[model samples]
Structures are given as structure tokens and as C-alpha cells.
Target: MGSATAQALVASSSALNAAQGITLDVAGELFSVGRLIGESTALSGALADPAAPAEARTSLVSRVFAGASAPVQDVLRAAVAERWSSAADLVDGVEELAVRATAIAAPDADIEGELFSVSRLVAGNADLELALGSRLGDGEGKAALVQRLVGASLNPATTLIVTSLVRQPRERRVRRLLNRAMRIVSAQRDRIVATVHTAAPLSAEQRSRLGAVLTGRYGRQIALNEVIDASVVGGLRVQVADDVIDGSIAARLADLRQKLAG
Candidate 1:
């Protein structure tokens, strides 16, 4: 996001945080608005056009989202009032707000874990990934597939988030979109994601210990998402934000080969 868009998001988030009645319902409404804008190039262009006056864009939002609740309207108004880099960024910003709002409404839920589980499921199954991420596929059909896959297990917040992303992936890969959602959920809880790739699944005890070590190192709580990669051979590769700790045997072997070649 550009500086202006980021500033707008922060301001809007602060307002939502301060509001008393913001709920998952509000987030759902925002998601609906985002989907509507994403599917309609004309609407997105009008809302995101920097050349258009902010008042006009907001007026447009009020008309298009007339039935949205006050809280939802507040968010949409704030979103459309900002200067976006492009029409697509406007949609992306709205979708991001929807995810964040869901996270805020479901503070006690394990939303980050749920999003990660869905991402892993999609990553492991090529057909499922294609079905959900396919641009040519019907949006409703993709939503139905998401419902069948995880609707029963997830909370309404997770369901809305996953369904919205799958239905309108825009230019994002499904796994990438889910990962971004997980990060947003983690940020809502004042935590960071620690993705662990290992040859075998870690025991609960191992996971706890790793979490403790990472927490001590980063000075923040970690939400661990484990990926079982047979190619790892041994040890693990840990990624916390941009910092990576690659202790896997595969990495070491590759380093040794590079040194030999040098």
C-alpha cells in the first residue's frame, strides 16, 4: 500500500476499534460491498478515481451501500474517501478491512489457525486449489466448494473471509491470499506468524518449545503454521516475517555444494 492508503486504513481501523457495536455482521457487509465493487469495473473506477472529488465518491458509496449498517457505512465511507493507487487497490483495501473487522469481532476465535489450515489444505490439493482459484470457475460454485470443505469447522468470521477471497481472488493465488488473511488475523491479536517447514510433523511439546524460543527472540507471541515437507530431510525451516532460520538438511546440503563449487 502507498503511504496515503496505509494512513487511511490505520485511521479507519482506529475508528472501528473505538466503536462499540462493530460486529461480524458489519464485516460481512463490507465483504459484500468489496465483492460488488470488484465485479463492477465502472463502480470501482468511480470510487477509486483520484480525479473525482472525495465528496462525490463518498456520496456514491452512500447510494450504492445505502442498506449497510451505520458501522459498515462508516468503514465504506472512510475507504472511498481515501486516494487509492488504482481501482484494484480500492477493492483490495476494502477486502483487507473486511478481514481485519472479522478478526476484531472474533477476538477469542482461532481465526489465524483456521486460515492457515485452509491455506495448507489448498496447497496440498492441486485440484481443490484450482477449483477455488480458477478465474473461469463460477464464483458461487467456488463459494459452495469452500462451504463443503470448511464451512462446518470454521466460525462465521472465517467462513466469510475464506469465501470472499475464494470467490474474488483478483490477481492473488489462493494460498497467498489465505496467508495474508492469517497475518492480518495475527496482527489483530498483536502476534506474528511463524511458519515452520519440517520433514515430519512436530509433536505438541516441540511446537510449544519452538514457540517459546521464537517468542523470546522476537519479543512477541507467535502463531505457528507447520508445513510437513518431506523434501526438508531433517530439522526445520522457520520463517518469521522476513527473517528466515533455515536449519533443514536440504538447505545445508545445498550450501555445502555451493562451497565446493566455489
Candidate 2:
């Protein structure tokens, strides 16, 4: 997943940095590039496009995000500039790097969350999400659409992230990478997340009750991500690793049917 990839990059960079004594503050620029890539399918496709030469692609990224931190540009060149082969792969690489850098820049903060969340606000809508993340359009169209929607004067860090991903693609889903990064970071500090699915949106009180129940049952603090799935039919399904607590009406129906058949 994206988080694992980001962590791998982080590990690689950590070793590389330690060996070469190259330290960087890449958060601002990394964010810039990550944002740009997320906003532009064309940019993502272009970066990963095999037709373009690596040097040319790297130069394009640098030119587009000229205002980003110099260190970030260096990191881009080192991590993805020459290694990317497809659009998806490049996006993944750039995104992973940005996620990692963002985490390091604000170790105890929610910078990555803020970045991804706000982006979801803009690109989260179904139409835009499909346009940006889908395979319906070619690379150029994706870039143009992104620029049209985001405008040219975005923050440098955001721009860098977006543009780099546009040019260099990743193989994994962007959200997955980000989530994994957040999870790994949180786990290191003893924070774990559990996703809760419901037949419909849960009330605040319900979420609170679920959280308390899950905490008591699991014996560990948990963060709940609520999702609505009408098919679940009036019950909850808490999924944490191999565990599943199905309180769904659907399950009850199946049980009843089985009993009748017996």
C-alpha cells in the first residue's frame, strides 16, 4: 500500500541521509507537489508516461514547482525523477515521498491529514474524483482539468506534490498510501484505527457508544471511521483484522433462513 511504500522510502532516505549526511526539511515542498499531482490526472499520467524521457520529465516537474524547497526538488530527482516508468507508479512514488516528509516535518501533527482532507474537500466530490483518479481521460486532459479547477496560484508545497504525481505516477491508490502512512505513524505512538460500517450514518451518540464498546472489547484505544452501507440493514459490522462483530439485520435474516431450512 501507499503507506508501506512511503515508509520504505522513509527507511531508504533515512539510511541514505545517515550515510551521506544529507538532511532536509522537505515538508513544504513535498506537500506542494503532492497536492498538484492529486489535482491533475494529466500531470500524473505525464510523469509516468513512458514516452517522455526521465530528464525531461524531472525538468518539467522542477520548472512547474520552482518555488518549492530546493531539498524537495533534490529528493524528487533522487527518488522518482529517474526511476518512474508509468504514470501510476510516479504518482505513487511522489505521493509516498510527500507523505513521509510531511510526517517527519510535523511528527506529532496532522499535516498530512489536513492536506489530504482539504484535497478531498475539493477533489472528493464524485465527479472530480473520477476525473482526477479515473482512467477515462488521457494525461493532457487530466492536467488541464486540474489546472482549471485549482488555478495556478496554489501553495508551492501543494503544487509540487500535485505536479510531481502528475508527471510520475504510483501503482497504489493515493488514499491508501496516505492512510497507511497515518496508521503506521499512529501505531508507533500507540494509536490504532478501526473502521466501522453501518447500514446508515450513525448518530454521534451511537458512534460514541460504539467506540466505548470497541475499546472495552479490544483492550486498546481505537479510532472509528464510520461508513454508511444500506445493505448492512440496521446493524453494525466492526472489522478489525480477523475480527468481525456482525450485528446486521442481513445476518439475522441469513440465520433465520438457515434455521427454517434445517
TM-score each candidate.
0.90, 0.50
Best by lDDT: 1
Q: How well is each residue in 138-237 modelled by candidate 2, as lDDT tens digits?
A: 6556556656665355443343344334432334454554355546444533455666778788898988888788888878777676667787888888
Model 1 gets an lDDT of 0.87
lDDT by residue for model 1 (1-262), tens = 7877777777666766776676888888888888999999999999999999999999999998898899888788888888887888788888888888898888888888889889888988999988777778788889988999889999888998999888888868999999989988787778999999999999999999999999999999999988888999999999998999999999999999999999
- Residue 150, candidate 2: how far off, in angstroms? 10
In candidate 1, position 58 carries an lDDT of 93
Alpha carbon deviation, residue 61, candidate 1 (Å): 2.0
Q: Which ten residues in a row have the lowest lDDT in candidate 2?
A: 15-24
